[model samples]
Target: MKTPLSPKSTSGLRGEYAGAGDDFTVEQDWQSYSPEAHDRWRRLYAAQSALAARYAAPQFLEGLAKLDSAGGIPRFDDANRVLQAETRWTLVAVPGFIPDAVFFDHLAHRRFPVTRWLREEHELDYLVEPDVFHDFFGHVPMLLDPRIADFLEMYGRAGEKAMAMGALDMLARIYWYTIEFGLVREEGGLKVFGAGIVSSAGETVYAIEDEAVLRLPFDPERVMRTAYSIDNFQQNYFVLDSLDQLIGSLVGLDFGPIYERWRHEQPLPAGQLQAGETPFKAVRLESLGERTP
Candidate 1:
């Protein structure tokens, strides 16, 4: 991968808060996409779907089926038809990741900004920043759930609040661990809800089956206090009992205090156990012990 980290810009869209100097808008060239571009989407879709089917959360899989997303690159208009009816969420086009505020603002309004660009064929397995496939296929399907839909809006506002308090680093941890790399326990077994897992074949299984990754109970404060890495496979996967459990706890939190405490605290390394003493086998056995009957 020559460039795993791709610079994403928000395409200019009139927003109530958009300022003159903001460089957030991403330019789109929808008509310029070639046959190879669409094929890449198909190839990734076929590959990731097979791997994720066993590892991904049932909700994510069900929503994906509801969206009828097996086809190649999803057209925003067609995707909106199903998404709007399912959760009233719409996918809008952006060049890439928009500015923090703009990104949050769009989510607050239930408008998800999907990059108009797809990853190159060689870059299918990974892309540093979110691309169209990451945005639409990975994240969009989950919006079909009513609870998750509301949670994302709240997540956006929480992000804005974190920015205002200069605590976005803390807030990003919450986003990274949950929205990007979260796992959930289902009747059958551990399943993936995180977009990062859904989009990557390697992570889809590693996040759930890898004994090296710590599977912690979902606590908003713990998540906010925890630090995460963006450049590699996650060393920890926060496990949620359910989406309701994850979102319900965050509705009333005021993170200013949380961030303040985090400032003085040392961040836990990716695979660090609670007390930082355990081999992967011990950690796995401990996890099995914590589950409910």
Candidate 2:
């Protein structure tokens, strides 16, 4: 028999929906979407696709192409056909952000919870909360890559332990820095792999081009101890040398010592380097003979 999903509070969630299961999943009901919604999706796709080609990681670009989502909001079932084949991942519709444990449970099982609603047209450039466009467009493409696919499952598995240890804050920072706002060195320059960067047109340019923002080399411990900003563009981005390094760094690694050591320590401020730390100098896009769009 299937385990019953426990009741969860919906307070602070912004997505409009009804009939969510105990797990907070709802049917995509793809046909119910209005033409205006589809058009909004198309506009978002058109604008972000251009930025992605210029600034996004090759894996993201390849995955975006494979998903074929440029026309409108993609049917989850259609995208699942490709996603499941590529990485055994599938999208499940949800009203919005669910509880952390529920969210982690879905990831642990390779079920990604995508919000079932789209953002308003006026809110295109920025939305305070993640809408379907942010979840599906920004996140699902990376799920197609095996490295990220594996890492996310591992992350989900780690969540329970984190919660029990009272270390969710530390674990969440890892997710925030790497999965949501990560940068990677590719083609002799920095390219975005983070979903947060890929989905926002303004941030796509700002993340890579802005001289004011600090880019730091990926250090799991430092990342966990660092604070992040959700209300604005990230002041700091963690740069990975390669996806392989990201996987290898955390696989079979114990976070116990790190958490124990730093759990009581004050969080490092975002955007400021600690004494004796040096920032990573990104290879300029112009140096690679690529023009910014």
Candidate 3:
């Protein structure tokens, strides 16, 4: 997902991924955004919020409301003010996609890099890169919860460790399947919690209501080792017993040895679901019962 940095700009930040001929860093002019962009943000915000109430996890709703999500294209400063006061998480603006090392560094320090741009109207429902709406709407609201915030910090620490171990691929799968496309079993039925799912109107319903997608139980080792695709609706979605169960399992586990063992192993494709082989089950998150470790 890395892109060559655009030509050097007067921005203070230096480019990390600029190609040999170019410097990547550029100053983001957040205020210069057009009225059309604001409309796009407002449209997206209103539409998604309506859908999310039905499909999104309850906590997501509460946090979204608490953040006053109705405002169009939130200003990082204003959003950060609220986020900082509530959970100490702040958003940093980045040009576009950043290197994994840089991304990990930001997360480790409780800074989430949000792109300052919004997608065009035609690009609605799908975009290859993370934008302001996706970053703030898709990801930020969850940060309001204490347990979820701690899990994110721990995840950042884990990312740093994984990078040192040369296991970024394995580590990314854990993020993709859990943070981006995860589901949780609720009394009503399966519900959406992953940002990736929340931001997509079609995928939101598909992930939660569709019988086609394979739903699997959450396992740290299995999740870390699994391979996922970003190009399509996930073929497999991992369901957690609860936020507490997910945090407890991963916040304490050592990924170094696990990554070492799984590095050379063949990765399972995004959609492979087998009852005995893949641990794909229909059990509710509450049904996980007691902790294993």
The TM-score leader among the candidates is 2
User: What are the RMSD figures for all models against the true structure?
Assistant: 6.0, 3.2, 6.3
List pairs with backbone clashes in candidate 2: none
Query: Whose lDDT is greatest here?
Result: 2
lDDT of 1 by residue, 1-293 (tens): 00112223223422222221243434344567788887788888888887766667788988888777666777778878998888889877765555677778778888877767777767866778677788778888888989888888887777667777777767778778877888877773577888888898888867766765677878787776676777888877778878888777787776788887785677766666676433322122135444322
| Candidate 3 residue lDDT tens string, 28-107 | 46678788888888899998998887778887888898888576677777778888998899887776666676677677
RMSD (CA, Å), candidate 3 to true, equals 6.3
TM-scores for every predicted model: 0.84, 0.95, 0.85
**Candidate 2 per-residue lDDT over residues 1-293, each given as its tens digit:** 00113335455556544578877888998999999999999999999998898899999999999999989999999999999999999899988767788888998999998988899989998987788899888999999999999999999899998988888889999999988899998977899999888999998988988888899989899999999988899999999999887888898778999989998888999999888788976466788897744
Candidate 3 wrong stretches, greater than 4 Å? 1-28, 275-293
Comparing 1 with 3 on TM-score, the higher-scoring candidate is 3
Clashes of 3: 0
Question: What TM-score quantifies how close candidate 2 is to the native fold?
Answer: 0.95
Cα lDDT of model 3 overall?
0.74
